[model samples]
Target: MMAAHGAPWFAGWGTLALVNAGLAQGKNRSGLGWFLLSLLLGPLATLLLVLLPKVRDRMF
Candidate 1:
């Protein structure tokens, strides 16, 4: 499917992955991990990040 559109398609996907990574970090999550996951899950990953609650900081 993506092959038909070529670089532009993958470029958009890659850009979305980067944006998702930033979103993850903003929520106190691992950006690198989420970026990797985004490569596979794409928009689904973004939906998950948006729906999930932010991690609360703990004083220990």
Candidate 2:
């Protein structure tokens, strides 16, 4: 059925979202925000994360 064919795709997308979340966290970004964004943007989110610079903490 159509559902069977789409299940793997959905699973992969979900996995990618998790990976993006971790990647975001590694860059000192919000994991949950990236996770939600990834759920909507998928690979595009990964590309954005890759292109983004890491956040540095300021010692004010």
lDDT of each: 0.95, 0.97
Candidate 2 per-residue lDDT, tens place, 1-60, comes to 345888899999999999999999999999999999999999999999999999997688
Best candidate according to lDDT: 2
lDDT of 1 by residue, 21-58 (tens): 99999999999999999999999999999999999876
Q: Candidate 2 regions off by >4 Å? A: 1-3, 58-60
Error of 1 at 46 (Å): 0.4
Clashes of 1: 0
Residue 38 lDDT in model 2?
Answer: 99
The clash count for each model shown is: 0, 0
